[model samples]
Target chain A: MIDRLAVIGVGLIGGSLARALRAAGQVGEIIGCGRSQENLELALELGVIDRYAQDPAIAVRDADIVFLAVPMGAMRELLASIGPHLATNALVTDGGSVKNSIVADARVAFGCMPPWFVPGHPIAGTERSGVGASFPELFRQRRVILTPLPETDPKATARVRAMWQATGAEVSEMTVAHHDEVLAATSHLPHMLAFGLVDALTRMDCSDEIFRYAAGGFRDFTRIASSNPVMWRDICIANRDSLSAMLARFSTEMSDLAASIRDADGEHLLEVFARAKAARDGFVDGGKSLAEHN
Target chain B: MIDRLAVIGVGLIGGSLARALRAAGQVGEIIGCGRSQENLELALELGVIDRYAQDPAIAVRDADIVFLAVPMGAMRELLASIGPHLATNALVTDGGSVKNSIVADARVAFGCMPPWFVPGHPIAGTERSGVGASFPELFRQRRVILTPLPETDPKATARVRAMWQATGAEVSEMTVAHHDEVLAATSHLPHMLAFGLVDALTRMDCSDEIFRYAAGGFRDFTRIASSNPVMWRDICIANRDSLSAMLARFSTEMSDLAASIRDADGEHLLEVFARAKAARDGFVDGGKSLAEHN
Candidate 1:
């Protein structure tokens, strides 16, 4: 059990984690920290955190585990603030979507990558945000990916994994580069497509009729387009290289698809669509899609 | 009241309409026709249809209304098969996703776009298809677009509109060209993106881990990828011009978004994301998303 846990940026991610730990009876005292005093008070009143701190440094002081759940753009400053004040035995982790940037920030903040700093990301979210939008069940049956640096302590990683496991999450580890690239394919690029598609329609088609007539499938398909924009922006910039590369590759494929349509190549369209359907059918039918929980 | 109704292709779309009409007591002598005799039998057994016919011609011989719900690829042949046999006073409409191709097919088969043929599309569907998946509530609170020709009988259009209204759908009308363009922007393009994205990832990534670790949001966003591949390929081929144009425009926008990411233009990214979110938020909150029904 965590004796004292510090969760900086106590919004959806951190607030949900705090609630999960509280529900599991796995934590002693949870301290919520964020730039928003009102949000922190809300978190405290909701019992998501036992107390609150406005500063990351004070929040992490003497804490057994410090979880930085702030947006990616704020991670560098957060790392710098908490590095000097964290207990020597304290384990530091994060819920940032991108790993390489967090690793880079840790390296710069500590002058060397500390063995206690374990970078991680929980692969779960909704089109909702804020402390009020969080719940203990958010991480249940979800995947939590950890990208531990080479110099990180194995015990730190293990403890982090155990903490996530207590919340009913499946945890695994991968290299920072691989995590970012894979996430680019699965998470980041999808967000970009959703955002870009809606934006394009809004700009090109002056009529709101375009969206009005969009079917239920389109609504479900573009649900992610309603996600928090600032957090996604920070993520886009943090994982720029992989996301940009994926977007370039996707754009080329789409162009090719357009050419096929132009050439009236129903055969090629059927081939690609059939293969895609097979992949998703297998995944969703496997009973491990994690789609049911959400 | 209708004395008889012939529903060619007794799958999700036609079967759902049959069930809805029966629930409302608005249809009589529902005749199911399809190439799949087993499926047609199932529709009859489930009460989605009152009788089964293997041939469209035989099915519509005395029917007062004919609702063609076959794939776009099959619509042309089905039109030809039923044209000579349709009742002289029949009101014929279709649930084809594309209007222009269906209209063109009717012109070729009947030697003219018949006054009784009202081209219509009900903007409702799920990834699941087949007669077993049909339900009376499929079209509840959904939008159905009708594109009636200038020569089409106004009484036929009004009756078709009333039939859909009986299913608790909000019915609207537009020209054939506008209907195809709007659907291309809203439905067709999103399907292409989902299918293409999944297909691209499967080809590039060798490990099944990409699909295994995909989050709930990713699964929901790509749910449409699991839709009937043959049907989508047919839609793509039928609405080639509009879909191709939309895809080209979307690919360009995606390329531009990628450039912003490569250049680290977080502001531009945030603006696009925020606007897109607003559009969806308004639409979903407006209680017209129809996502709740599905």
Candidate 2:
């Protein structure tokens, strides 16, 4: 059974994991690694981790499991630095939003795609980021989709799934490519549209007063536009191909809607809105885990 | 002093106004009118009004203040029926979102612009509709923008403004045309985009799974899409010209962002996200009043 665990890049996701693991008594000790000494200190002070390490490489030593909780762009550098120190028997995984690029990089950094390495994308998070926002139950009732390549070690995959389940997340499996495409349609594309909507709204001359008078409708539409830019930037670039395809498709749909509106086709507008409302209601009723805890 | 007040529609907005007037001891007797007898009965039961009525003409009789709180599309029809009954000395105001069309219709219905008619839109509401959701404090700390036409009476406008102040709402004035244009960008466009985004995302093959896996981000983004579609449909049609113009502008900007993604331009993507982040932060810091009460 896995006992000791190390978490790299102790931000919102990692810090939450540490808190959840410790609260559930799922791990004997949790080690935190980050570039910011102050954040590491804060994590230790909050008892989110049992120890802190300035060097990423040494942080993984003697750990039975390690999570690379950093951004996708930083994953390769992080994996390269920690690769030599990783015990062959230790299972490695990630909480990245995108998977294909990370999976490819992990294969390169670990000599071959180690059986102990599993790629995961937890479909949960908040607009707020950082260690301060970390909560133990952040992932409670949330889905954690794992993209296990064909050569993945069965035992390693099982351990990873068990660990996620212990943290109160429902575990599901998909191929790396499928995960990317699905997330692009559901998550990434929505984010891009939100950001684009806000940008469009703000440029209007009277938007300041308009935003002031904005009801719950505007607030909800622009919510995702308030997310962390750097993280989203990386995700968009890392999964550029799929996201681009999704965006193209979305643009076509939007153009059609706009045309219908221009033509004063009330029937078409109502049809689209009704379809969306029904689909959204159906999804909510289906009861999927919205986020993973810890 | 406005001794008798008539509130048309008796839904959340009208009921809340009636309740506030009674709660503040501002009106001698409040008469609530609506096509829905059940809604009027419940409004009286909830103490939202002092009495109820079925006919627009009878409700406005001898009323020193008359508030038209029906849906935007119904405003013209209501005004036509009540125009003959509106006392020349009475202050006639509305709770409609779009002002230009309503104001124009009011002018035509009265054969000339009634000096006492004032057009106002309160920038406050909850997701729940109908009289049951009405509360005295719904307008507190919220904005109530008034758009008084050139022919509006000064005394009538002052009376309406004072009434809104009694509910603790700050009143601001603008032209009806400008108000419609501004709201199209801020309120209408956002709802349209949110509905479209939710609709687009939920139609995917894994929609049920995606909805199940949706986090706070997706929830927030689509929350507004759950609003009453008929109300939104009326709004879009009432302000179709401005909404269509705003949508065209928004589409142009969305296309630019889509083009950047297609080219895999990380720098451009980061720049766009960064700008949007800053804009949202600035908006929040500006103390703009889009705060959700629920």
Candidate 3:
């Protein structure tokens, strides 16, 4: 059980982690900190946190555990500010979408890769954001991926895993590069496609009619386009390499599809479509392992 | 009420139309014709059709309305065979995704554009297809766009519109070119993207881990990728010009996005993302007109 938990940036992930630990009766005191006083107060009223601290340094000063849940853009500054005040033994982790960049931020801030810092991410969310949208059950049955540096203390990693497991999340460990690469394919690329598609349509001369005649299929395809743009912008900049690589690969295949259509190659079109349907069906029905966890 | 309604294809759209008309007491008889005898038998058992016919010519022989729900690739053959058998006054409409090509098919089959033929497409469906996957309420509150040739009889178009309206669909009319262009951007483009995205990932070395780590967003984005491959293939080829054009425009934008990501131009990414979110929000919250029918 956590003696004192410091949650910096009381947003969806931060607030939910606190709520889950409180609901599971596994935490003593939760200190919420953010730039937004209103959001911190809402977290306190919602019982998502025990008290509020406007200063990140103050928030992490006496905590046994500290969670960084702000957007990717804020991670570097927060890490720097809290580094000087953190309890020597506090296990530090984060819910940042991009692990490699934030791990670099930790390395720079702490003047080295701290053994107490365990970088992690929970693959659970809705379109909504903010503390008001958080719930204690947000992480239940979800997957939390941790990418701990080799020099990290095993006990620190265990504590982070135990915290997530307490919230009913299945925790898995991977190398930082692998976590970034896998998520770039699974999550980041899809969001970029959705955002790019919508942005492209809006730029067209027929934009008005395009959205007007859009069917439910179009809506579902663009659902992720409605996601927070600033956060996604940060994500784009955070994981630039893998995302650009995936985009180039996808663009090549897209050009092939366009050529196939131009040539009216029914056989080629059918083969690609059939293959896609098979892979998507397999993934949806049960990706050898997807069905087990999700 | 119609004396007899002949529905060729007998899949999701065709079966649902028959069930809706029957439920509303607007259709006197529904004769389902398809390549699959088992599917037709299931439709009859489910009361989606009053009877079944193996040949399209025999099916449309005595019908007042002929609804062609076959894939775009099969439209030419069905039009040719049914041309000699259809009643001169039959108001023939279709559920094919492409309008311009189907009109071409009708012209080729009849040696001219028939006044009795009115092409229509209902913008409603689930990922599931086949007669068994159909339901009567599928078109309720959904939009159906009809495109009629200039030489087409107004009464024929009106009858087709009334037929769809009776099934709780909101019907609108536009020229064949407009219908093809609008649908290519809204429906066809999104389907192609989903199919292409999934197909590209499957070709990657990390395809196994890609599908395994996929989250709910990836699943939702690829939902349409699981649609009937043959039908999508037909749609892609049938609307080749417009679909290819849209793909080119979107691909250019995708390249720009990739360059911005590589350059780490946060401003470009932020602006594009914000604009897309705004437009998507407007459409989803009710595009100037997307709000009404859907």
- Measured on C-alpha atoms, candidate 3 has an lDDT of 0.89
For candidate 2, write residues B8-111 as lDDT tens digits: 98887888888887888888988989999998899888888888879999999989999998877788889999888877678789988888788778877877
Q: What local lDDT score does residue A206 receive in model 2, on the 0 to 100 scale?
A: 68
| Least accurate 10 contiguous residues by lDDT in model 2 chain B | B285-294
Residue-level error in angstroms, candidate 3, position B128? 1.5
Give per-model TM-scores: 0.97, 0.94, 0.97
- lDDT by residue (A1-294, candidate 3, tens digit) is 999999998888888999999999999999999999999989999889989889899999889999999889889889999888988778899999999899889878878999999999999877667899899999887789999888899999999999999999889999999988889988999898899999999988889878878888888899889888888988889999888888888889999999999999999999999999999999987744643654
Regions more than 4 Å wrong, model 1:
A287-294, B288-294
Give the TM-score (0 to 1) of chain B in model 1: 0.96
lDDT of 1 by residue, A90-126 (tens): 9999999999998998888889999998999999988
lDDT of 2 by residue, A129-233 (tens): 778889998777778899888889988889889888877888999888888888887789889978887777677676677667666566666778888888898
Candidate 2 colliding pairs: A16-A294, A17-A294, A139-A291, A139-A292, A139-A293, A140-A293, A142-A291
lDDT of 1 by residue, B1-294 (tens): 677989998889999999999999998789989989889878878888888889788999899899999999998888888888977899899999999999888888888888998999999999988999899999999989999999999999999999999999989999999999999999999999999899888888543878877888888889999999899989999999999889888878888888888889988988989999998788787654354653
